[model samples]
Target: MHLILLLSGLSFQFSHGLQPQFVFFQTPKTWSEAQNICREQCFDLATTHDMREMETLLEVVKDKYDDAVWIGLSKGKTRRWRWSLADDDFYKEGERSYLLWRSITDDNCAVFSNGKLNMYSCETNKYSVCFDATKQGADQYILNTQRMVWTAARDFCRAHYTDLTSLRNDAEYQIVQQVANGSEVYVGLFRDPWEWSDQTDSSFRYWNPDMLVRTDSTQTCVAMLKVNSGKWGDRACTETHPFVCNCIVKKLSFIKLRISPQDSMLDLSNPSVQADILEQMSQKLRSYNKTAGFHLKWRKQSDGRVFTKEP
Candidate 1:
């Protein structure tokens, strides 16, 4: 007895998937006006989560847009200091909230030098200390001899070790000082006033050195400079410029497929068989469009079985 799989004329809509799209507007408008227009057409002003998203946004900018363009970042009303080691599990009760700054300044990044905590410009190049949680005893803190800015040092630490050293208490501070070895080192502590227009919690920042030094409070809105390697810079919100907008759309699609069983004893009602079928279909879909991401699953019937036998 040969078992034949039948094709259904009906295509089922399983789930909705979200994908991001970046749109550029050449018309000049203030940041607020641009944001309003973006909301009207798309989702909101563009907000990037990481370098990959930033690169995607850059791809939207071609010969038509060579100057700076407004993004979703803007200066917040208040500033807060936080550690680069953002893992909450590493800290107990009030440890993450602890601060031991000897003096605060216009600078945003922190450094330990000459036996005192001082705020320094984030652009200043200095040696950094990395913390290794897996190491035992005195091997926790490792010092990097190469000089780098605060952000670069944090990146290096995250790539190699756990993260830049976070001083949770006095004992941790002593260990960090020993790692510094009388030389100034960039610590995990830093403060920022910038906030995303979409109200996301992404802490990733890519600011030019010039923008980091500016103390202008009126320069609230941020722009991505195509001429300066897409580095972000703060500008007045009232200044008119071409802006980028982002839309995250949920798309529903119906896919149809046909299956033929070579073996007469094959069971199509089995869960494993349904999973294998979905996997094969997913691979075929990927071959057609490499960039389009989607999830695949078998649609169940009223009895919770994926496939039903036909008379």
Candidate 2:
């Protein structure tokens, strides 16, 4: 009898829905390169179908890597978003959700942009993420010095590392600033009024503080880490100085969840039970969505008090 009961329990466990496990690559690679790498290794680029999986992946890689890598999700030729590796037709089902990984609309493909750890289109030129056999590692900060046109430098960085050294955040910016103050290496700090690249449809610009200086119509380029006080100055991009490149480190973890048998008891059969289960599941999903996987407790609607219900 005990053996039969054990077998039945095992069967029940298998019958419940199970969450898929996902892996991530932290090394930057171009979209195609990333896909090729993943294919060669018998692994597909990472994709997140729900918020729980996304959070689990983020926590896993939070320490192992820093720079973001490419994932399997993309907006394909049909302009209909689809998972690059999965055959399922793209169906959002009108559910509003938050994206834990980076996503780009125009390019239809996604890349992890350096600094911001956000998504971008594959067609868009930016740094890429790559992976190896044992464990995929993050980008390492590298410094390169070169002489080229402003356009050429941008191109070079796109081909090689992350963009011409955009600051990742306030902490990173301060670090770069301190380094420039000491060695006077030219950073990405530029002086030209930021303009949109013709390739992109939007006209958005983000310039570092005091990085732009308007001296004359001839000042077409910008320079960083001036010799005296490490202030920004205008110079031709062609001017040569040692440049900085960043290698990002990212940590990734794959988590899989299997619904408990007791939890599954919330009848998926009867219409009323199905509706109630769906309503509860929706509420739980909404709670998960709000924090992007951060822990949150349920609260009362009237008094804003946290409460737990007993089954």
Q: Which candidate number has the best lDDT?
A: 1
Estimate the lDDT of model 2. Answer: 0.31
- Model 2 Cα displacement at 24 (Å)? 3.6
> For residues 25-112, what per-residue lDDT tens digits would candidate 2 score against the true structure?
5454554555456434423344343334445554545444332333333221222222211111221332212122333333223322
Model 1: residue 279 alpha-carbon error in angstroms: 46
Model 2 worst lDDT window (10 residues): 7-16
After TM-score superposition, the amount by which residue 20's alpha carbon in candidate 2 deviates from its true location, in angstroms, is 3.0
Q: Against the true structure, what is each candidate's TM-score? A: 0.56, 0.22
Q: Residue 204 in model 2: shift from native, Å?
A: 26
For residue 158, what is the lDDT in candidate 1? 68
- lDDT of candidates 1 onward, in order: 0.72, 0.31
